[model samples]
Target: MGFQKRPYEPTLFVKIGENGKMLIACLYVDDLIFMGNNKGMFSYFKRSMMNEFKMSDLGRIHYFLGLEVVQSNDGIFVSQKKYAREILNRFKMQHFNPTNIPVEFGLKLTKAGRGKKTDSTFYKQIVGSLMYLTSTILDIMYAISLVSGYMECPTAMHLLAAKRILRYLQETKDFRIFYEKGEKADLIGFTDCDYAEDQDSIKSTSGYVFMLGTGAVSWSSKKQTIVTLSSTEAEFVAATACAC
Candidate 1:
């Protein structure tokens, strides 16, 4: 979506006949997702669109939104291996030793005298790269979220934590999400929150992920904007945010 705000204007429209069904196509800037039951109908729709505007057919949808998709007789597979490797090489992390985990579990990262002033730029650069990488690499979500806390004024400890995430990526560079042909098409979701997780602001962080079949289709992680009176309230708010 464009960042600028303007009056409403309709650029695309759809209509369906009473006896005929129409496919639903959702577009966000250049990214699009199309759903339809009839292959013939989709083909007709594509032809009409092509007649109206000049477009190039990229052949079957193999990649979109930084995610690489591979379709086989068995099913479809999605991965960001190329994007991950690019990030690693861009930050000069590809040659480093790989780690088993993105971050140490139960590790509390606090903003204090934990980092050195000389490495502030390096820390920011790493975090920014990781943030870009996380757009398609959901497995790195938690680690990137944790390391992002120190962006304001990073320390040596924070830099180490961010580097650990990169190292973890180095180890799991080939991982991908596979959607098999026989798997049922189902939508499921999970929500979680860490109360007062941020030591400095005492603000809780809420996260949720929604899966379709075997792949994560949507997910988010955000800090609570308002303080909650109790744990229950915090949980309720986080759930509401997740639902929305």
Candidate 2:
């Protein structure tokens, strides 16, 4: 679809098959995602598509859908450094000082009003941009998820917390996921839980990261569905959630 026609038809679907190898391309708006087992076949398909279409070859998929794609001899690394900078610049926060962490270690974000009020539209715009940035930047999942809870009617404190995340991104803008290829290609998962993390709802937050070989490609941080009485229960719940 043309850039101007994106809103009308936001997705494009294509399938390529050659010599028992199949490749699928899913294009959402301006983002294109391709998957196939055979790298050579995929490359050929991409070239063919470019020949038949007006699309510009991004060259090895370094950036797409807010994710920065890095290909190496070993594997692929994906992150969102560009998305982070876009967010910072959108909020006029590119000049802000960098921080070590996305959020304060012991800080608890609640709906209580404590900070100065600003334009709600600006706050929502920042939140939406950050949410898009998180699609490829899983490192900021926890902080983004926490701040997203206040989207309904964000307060100044919530905006500050969100800004802090931008500050954190400024410090770690160079960080990227390294998908290394090795003998150990098995999928490994890690899970952790925090009991009663949300003071307002008293709900636990669970997080998990899945690594393929030496690189992490999938992860999530979310609040648990049910309340648990103990840390063991919370951990077990988190484990079960990860299993799904």
Candidate 3:
């Protein structure tokens, strides 16, 4: 009953233990998922939840919100293989040839009036589908970030880039992020930025990823608002954003 709601993440509740035991629970609407190092706390919480409301115990989480979690004796592996395939089929790219990379090297996407105009609606859908896959497919983060910027007025070039991403996904749809058990739990973070990569506005893009133990817990890739004079400044901005 000593559950404390987190200020930043209000939907999450935690029971801190001084005796090296703790419980963490995430509440999403009517669904409740909780995990802990103490079995006693789990039983108590389950009993309390059952007494207060009518709910069924779904047991261990295998799938939730398009994310599939495969739990083994050593760790938990998270993936979106089914979702990725569905995306490919939804856009009729399932039978297309797979690519080695999501985005081509030295590819500089711009808003210049050169390529033929494509359906903005369709392009948005493609970019949106790939956006969620970034939840586990870290490799496509930069590519998704690039294509998402063109959603407002996507051209044929943008559409092709988006398709390339799906093709890349088709090639690497089985990728998963595994969180393995370890003697120590360390938080590690990485930050990167492309100096003036956007030709239209000459803006830099910043990206960051933070990993807890063997799996990434948080990440972001976005075009920076302000332009930096040098790569060093761009990197600093990216790092500062990452720290925040």
lDDT of each: 0.77, 0.78, 0.90
TM-score of each: 0.81, 0.79, 0.95
Kindly report which residue pairs in candidate 1 clash with one another.
115-155, 115-156, 116-156
Q: Can you write out model 2's per-residue Cα lDDT over 1-244, one digit (the tens) per residue?
A: 2112234344634444557666656677665667767888667777877888777765567666667777778777778777778878878899999998898888788877567665778878877787776666677889988988887777788888889988988898778777675566888999998999897889999999998877776799999988899999999999998998
Candidate 3, 47-158: lDDT as tens digits: 9999999999999999888899989889999999999999989999999999989898888787753489999999988888889998899989989988888888888888
Q: Distance from true position, residue 112, model 3, in Å?
A: 2.8
Writing each residue's lDDT as its tens digit, candidate 1 over 189-230 gives 998888887777888888889888888877877778988767
**lDDT (Cα) of model 3:** 0.90
- Please give the clash total of every predicted structure, in order: 3, 1, 0
Q: Which candidate tops lDDT?
A: 3
Cα error, candidate 1, residue 193 (Å) = 1.7
RMSD, candidate 1, Å = 4.5
- Lowest lDDT block of 10, candidate 3: 106-115
Q: Mind sharing the TM-score for model 3?
A: 0.95
- Candidate 1 similarity to native, TM-score: 0.81
